[model samples]
Target: MALTSKDFKYVSYLWDDAKAASLQGDEVALLLYRSNLLGADLRLTNYGGGNTSCKTTEKDPLTGTDVRVMYIKGSGGDLGTLKRNGLAGLYLDRLHALKKIYRGLEHEDEMVALFNHCIYDLDSKAPSIDTPLHAFLPFNHVDHLHPDAAIAIAASKDGKQINEALFEGQIGWVDWQRPGFDLGLKLQACLEESPGIKGILLGGHGLFTWGDTAYESYVNTLEVIEKYSAYLHENFGKKKPVFGGVKMQSLAPEKRKEQAAALAPVLRGFCSSYTRMVGHFTDDERVLEFINSKEVARLAKMGTSCPDHFLRTKICPLVLDLSPDAALNDSQALKEKLQPAFDGYREYYRQYYEDHKHPNSPGMRDPNPVIILYPGVGMFAFAKNKQTARVAAEFYTNAINVMKGAEAVSEYVSLPLQEAFDIEYWLLEEAKLQRMPKPKPLSGKVALVTGSGGGIGKAVAEKLAGEGACVVVTDINDERLKETAEEFTKAFSRDGFITAHLDVTRGDTIESCLKEAILAFGGVDIIVNNAGLSISKTLENTTLKDWDLLQDVLVKGQFLVSRAAVTVIKKQGLDGDIVNIVSKNALVSGPNNVGYGAAKAAQLHMSRLMAAELGGDHIRVNVVNPDAVIQGSNIWAGGWAEGRAKAYGISVEELPAYYAKRTLLHETILPEDIANAVFVFTGGLLSKSTGNVLNVDGGVAAAFVR
Candidate 1:
C-alpha cells in the first residue's frame, strides 16, 4: 500500500501547437491539461471514471457581459483524453439556486430537466449529476475521484475514524448518501462546519478535494491519497490476510486457457438470444489466484466496493460452472451444461430484486451477468461491445485488488443495499443511458481475418472494426501480426482487436487460431480467407515442391480454416458469412502460372461446395476474384511483381497502368475496393446472394460469369 507515485511529465509537448493556437481558450486548455494529468493515472481515475471542474467567468458573446460559469466534465467524457468541448459550461448562479428549492421536490426525476435548464449556453453538453457538488464548493477547482487507495479506506467500516486519524483531523466526513442534490448539500454543510478542512471523504463512496487552482486541487488530491496509502502500508507491512480455512480447487494454468477457449463460444452463443455479448479471457496470475481461491465464492457474492461499478457491472457477478467434461464438448454440449446454471441465475436475480425493490421502482435491467467467473479458466466479461467488455473486465480486476486490501486490513464491508439500488437506478445515470448512441450494424458480430498482416486482409479487418465488429487478425508472420494489432489498438480498444499467429497450411495451427478467436471474441460471425501465395511457372516446368506449397496455402488453407470456423458459426446458431479472396485466374487461366491458377480454381470450386453445404446452417459463402490489385497487395510481392511485369512486357512501374488499360473501365483496383465488395457481402447488405463470384478487377469482362 506504499504510495505509488508516477513521475509526472509536463504534457504541453503532447499537444498540437497549431491546433491549440487556433482555439485559444485559456480556461478550457487549463481544464484539459488538468483532466489529462489526473486521469492518465489509473490509480487516480480509470478511462471514463472520475469528474473534474473549474469555476471561471466568460463574457457572453451576445450580451458582452461577463458571467460566472461552472465547467464540469460532461457526462460520458473520458478524462484521460478530454478536450475543450468535453466540459459543459453551466451558469453557477443558476445551478446553485436549484439547491435552495431542491428539498421540496417529491421525486428526483426532474433532476435532468433542472440541470438542462441551468445550462447558460444552448450548445453546451449536458452536465454531470455532480455539478451541484462542484457548485456547492467555494473553491475555484474541484475533483471527485474513486481512487483505489482512497476507496479502500472509504469502504471500510471505520472509514470516518480512519480518515480523521490519517488526515490529522483536517478532513470532513459525511455518512453514505446517494449522490445528488441532498448529498451536495450535506457536503456543503460538512465543509462549513469544519472551516479549515482540506477535503471531504464520503463514507463508502470516494474522495473529494478542492483548491484555488487546477494545479493546487490536483496536488491536494494526490496528498490525501498518499496519506491513505501510507496508512495501510505502515500498518499492514506486506501482511497477507487469510480469510478462509478451506482448501481451494482450480484447474492448472495450461488447462485454464485450454478450457476457456473451448467454453467461451458456448456461453457467448447462449447469451446472444437476449444480449449481444463479446467475451474476453484473462488469466493474469493475480486473477487466476484470486478466482480460484476457496474464499472467492463467498466474498465475491457480497457486492461491489463502490457504486460506480454497479451500472456497468451489476452489484453481483455470475459465477459459472466449469466441469472438465464440458470443456472437451462442442458448443451444443456446453450449452446443455450452461442452460441450468443460467436458469438458476435468472431465478436468483428475480428474487433478489423483489426483496429489495419498492413497488414503484424502475423495472429490472437485463438480468444477464456482466462479469463471469469461469472457475478453472479465470475471468470473462460479456458486454454489447469490446470496449465495454474490457471496461467491465478492468473494473472487476480493480475490485479484486480493492477487496484484497480491505480484507487484509479487516473483513471487507460494502455499502448498504438500499444505497446501491438507488445509485444503480439514479435518474442522471438513466439519462446518460438514453443519450448513449445506437449500436452499429455489426455491433455484436465477431470477425476473423486471415493474412491480416497487411494489404487486402488488413483493409478488410479495419473496415469491419469500423462497422463495429470485434476483429481477430491472423497472420503467418508474428511481427506483422503484432504491428497490425498495435494499429487496431490505436483505432479501437485492445479488446476490440485480438491477434493470432497462424500458418494457415498447418492443420494444428489452424485449429488453435480458431479456438483463440472464439476465446477472445466468443464466436466468429464473419470469416475472410485471404491468405495465399503465388507461383509463376508452367505446368510442365513447375517443381513438385512449388506445386505443393501453392496448393497447401491457396486451396487447403481455406478449406481447413473454414472447416473450423463453420463449426463455431453453426454452434452459435447465427447466420454467418465467409468471403474468399481468389484470383481472376480462377475463372480465366494465366499463362505460365499453372500452380497458382490451378490452386485458385480449386479454391473457387471449394467455395461453391461450402456454400451449398453450409447454406443449410444459414452460413453464406461467397468469393471475390480480382485480376491485378497490385496497389497495397502482398500477393504480388517477393519478385512476383517483377515476374508479372516481365510477363506483361512492361516495367514494374508501368504494370499498374498496363493492367488498368486491360480492364474495360480503365481503372486499377485498390485493396480497399476489394474490401468494399467483401464488406457488402459479409455485412448482409446482399442477403439474398450467396455462392457468387464478384470480379473486382475494374469490370473485367473476360472474368465475368455472365
Candidate 2:
C-alpha cells in the first residue's frame, strides 16, 4: 500500500464541529487522532507496542505562566483506543534538563522518579520509558513503533545495508540499545551525524518517524513500511510466507476444531507452574503453513521477532505436537509427552538469565512459556487473563509476519539472548507487572452453555463470563445467539466468548458446537444443559409429535451433550461440573402440562445417574429446578404464558404477579435468579453436594426439599 496525502486530510477532518474545536484547543488531541489512526492499522503496530507524542504549550499548574509541554503516550496504554487520560504531559524545560543530566542517574529507579517529578500535572499518568527519546528529538511530533514490515527489514541479517540503500541520506540508523536514558543519548548522536533525516530505523528494535506535524510523522512511517513491503514482494513473488519444507495433512474444519478442543486443557495444565492460565488457539493460514515447516521448532525457538516482544511472549515459544494421534492421548500419556519439553525450556531460560544478569539486576522471571506452537493444530497463547492472552497471541502473530518477511529476503536474525533479557526485565516493565489486578476465581476456567440465545441460558453464560470464565454459547436462533455473544464480550471487555448455531436435538450439530466451544477456550470445565421446550396439554389431548419434541430435546439432548463432555473432561483429568436446568414442574405437576412435566422428570433422573457414574472421575453433576421466571426469558414466549394463564383463569399480564404473590416471599423470580442458583452449583461452592437439586422458585412448598 502506498502512502497518500488524502490520508492526512482525513485525520484532520472531524465528525463534530464542537468536539473538533475542543480538541483543536489542545495539541494532544491531534496526537491521539494520529496515534489511533496508526495503531488501528495492524501493519503499523499492535497490542501496546507503540507510543506517540506532541510538543505544545499548556498553563503551569502552580503558576499562571504558559509553559511548554510534551504530551506522550503513557505506559501500558493501547494507542488504538487511547483517550485524553492516556497521554502523560511533562514540562518541556524539566524534561530537557533531565536529558542533559540523565547520565548521572545510575539506577533505572532514579530515572523513573525524575520522570515522575517532571510531570506537568501532579495527577497525570506516568510517561513511557521512551519519553526521554521524544524529549531529546527536536521535532514537534514523534511516533515510535515496532511495525511488522519495518521490523522485518530491521531484523534481517543485512538490515543496516538495506536501510542505507532504501532511504540513503534521508533516514538515520541506531544499533540495538537498552531503551532508557542511554538510548535517548544514542538517538541524539545519530541525528547529529545525519541531519534532516525524516525517519530512523533501530537495529533489532523498531522504527521511529517524526516531523513538524502529527500527520507528516504518521505518513512518513507508512511510506517507509510500504517500501519495505514492496521490497519483500519483489523478491518473494507476493506469496504468503510460511515455514519451509514441513507439512501437515489438512482436516475438515469440524475435525480440526475437535482436535484443537481436545488439546487445549492438556496444554493449559502442562504450561502452568504456579497459577492456572487461560488458553486461546489459532489456526490462521499463515500460522498453519509456518508451523507445518520442518524448521518450525528451530526458527520459533531462535528468538522473538522484535526485542520488546520478549516481555510479552518470552524469549521463544514452547513447541508441541498436536497431530491426530497426539490429540487423542489420555491425560497420563499427554503429560509424559510434554514433561521433557517443559523441563528443557525451563532449564534453558534459567541458564540464559544466569549468564546475562549483572549485580543487583532483578531476579529471573517465571520460566514458563507464554506462546505455544503446535504444528498441526496451530498456536496457543496463555495468560492469567483472556485479554492479555490475546495480546500475546497477536504479537506472536506479528512476529511470524516479520520473521517470514525477513527470511524471504535473507536469514531472519534476532537480538542475542543478553539483549532480550535486558529488554524483558527492564525496570519500567517490571513496575507495570507489579500493578496487575488480582485474578478472578474462575479466571482460567472455560464453560459451555446451550440455548444461550435467551432466558436462563443467556443469563448463565453472561454471569460465567463476568466471573472471568471464557464462555462458549450456542442456540438454534442465529440472530439471538450473535446478539448474546456480542453482549457477553462487551460486558467482559474480552474476546473470550464464541457463538455457534446449535439445535440440541441433532447429534451432529451438538457434536460440532462442542468442538467450537473447545477450540475457543481450550477445554470445557463446566457444561450447562439449559436447552428446553414445553408442550402444555392434558394427557388425553397430547399428540405424539408434541411428546416426541419435548422428550427428544429435554431428555435425549442432555444425554448427548453430557456424554461428549465427559469424554473430554476425562481426557483433561481435571474435575468438571455439569448442571441440568430442570423445571419446578418436575417436582410438582401442573394442570395440562403432562408432556413438559414428564420430560423434565426424566432429565432430572438422568442427572442423578450421571452423578453416580462420573463421581469416581471427580466430575460432579447437579440439577437446578426453577419456576415462573418471566423477565428476560424466552420460555414464556410462543403463547405458553397465555396458555398457563388460561388454565389458572387469569389474564396473561397478571400471571407474573399471581405467581409472585403465591410464593412464600411474595417475590417474582427473574432469569438471573436461576442463573445464580446454577452458578452456586457449578462453581464448586457445593463441591460435595452432587446428585442434589437446588430450587430457584421463590420458595414453593411442593418444590421444597423434604
Among these predicted structures, which one has the highest lDDT?
A: 2
RMSD of each: 4.4, 3.7
Model 2 TM-score on a 0 to 1 scale: 0.90
Worst 10 residues of 1 by lDDT: 7-16
**In candidate 2, what are the lDDT values of residues 488-524, reduced to their tens digit?**
7677665668888988888899878877766666667
Residue 51 displacement in candidate 1 (angstroms): 0.9
Q: What tens-digit string does per-residue lDDT give for candidate 1 at 265-319? A: 7677666667668877787766665676677788778878677766677887878
Runs of candidate 2 exceeding 4 Å displacement: 1-26, 100-106, 237-258, 321-335, 350-366, 489-494, 646-649, 683-689
TM-scores of all candidate predictions against the true structure: 0.88, 0.90
